[model samples]
Target: MADPQPARRPGGRTARVRGAVHRAVTELLAEKAPDEVTIAAVAERSGVHQATLYRRWGTMTGLVEDVVAEVLNRGSPIPDTGSLRGDLSAFAVNAAAGLASPMGTVYLRAIALGVGPAEGAPDGGHPGFDARAQQLQEMLDRATARGEPVPTLPDLLEVVLAPMYFRALLLKQPPDEEQAHAVVDRLLALTRG
Candidate 1:
């Protein structure tokens, strides 16, 4: 298992520390390879002690996972736009916008390439994968609650997200609004009753 996210205390000392740490991680990643970003460097940039980083993050991979999580979690929660089509469309468009960013591309590549075994994951699965799956499930649950018939998780991944991720991660191209709308329309046509 990955370490749980830090307890959020808005505008408090803890939040400030996490924000500083996240900023340091972003700056260092922009400057160097993921493999070269060390706790000492992060501490130096963040003004948070190395000991605090070690105590909180446990390992380099743990720190990386947190950094990915923080970046991905910012700005939005999954869309809940009343109608399933509307929600999925909003989600796809927002996601495409995110993947289009340089930092977003770097973060995705790092998580896909560098994430591996950590303290809680003895079986060696990436927690980021698990986190993404959970997010997808939440979206499906929202759709179901809205009385839309949702596809199973595997089908959702295959039919809905696969094209989006393939274009964003593999082709290194973000979908335009028309492309995003097409994806949402196709998925809704397939799954909606």
Candidate 2:
């Protein structure tokens, strides 16, 4: 029998290329609107061939989806600060900071505008939103495990995340720490009832 191929390591050349491409996309999104970020621009910025980009990502939407997923996963890691309040507060603050950033604003608007998959996501949802929902659920599960009174994911989303997103994406006002804390407090108050 022919020798089986070795499993591909994550830190290989492929990962380097992906990292470069993602960084290039991020920088471009930070500097300009999502509509202005083209595959050719990414190719030039990343020093990777346009053919390579087309072969790997298939489309600009695909590339944006990948970048959004990577950013959402890496940017705001779920906190484990022992108490629900601390965790929620930390998460809110981090989320506020991220949403306030130039790249964050672009990506969040992209996600909100459904710039990713057309359909067929797990639970018939956008992958970026699903990933964030999963992260929120993980935090809620941790709080439950600690015997803490936890609010529903919808409640958290409505009371905390929605306002931040609205402010950043619609109002053109990224939330500051004080606003984040106030939102957290509002969520906590609702959960206390």
TM-score of each: 0.75, 0.84
Which regions of candidate 1 deviate over 4 angstroms? Answer: 1-12, 117-142, 145-147
State the lDDT of candidate 2 residue by residue for 12-93, as single tens digits.
8887888898889888877877678899999999999999989887777767777776667676578799998998999999
| Residue 107 of model 1, lDDT score | 74
User: What TM-score quantifies how close candidate 2 is to the native fold?
Assistant: 0.84
CA lDDT for candidate 1: 0.73
- Cα shift from native, residue 9, model 2 (Å): 1.7
lDDT of 1 by residue, 42-61 (tens): 99999999998888887666
Q: Quick one: best lDDT, which candidate?
A: 2
- Tell me the whole-model lDDT of each prediction, alpha carbons only: 0.73, 0.80
Q: Candidate 2, which segments miss by more than 4 Å at Cα?
A: 1-7, 116-124, 128-131
The candidate 2 region of ten consecutive residues with least summed lDDT is 1-10
The local distance difference test score of model 2 is 0.80
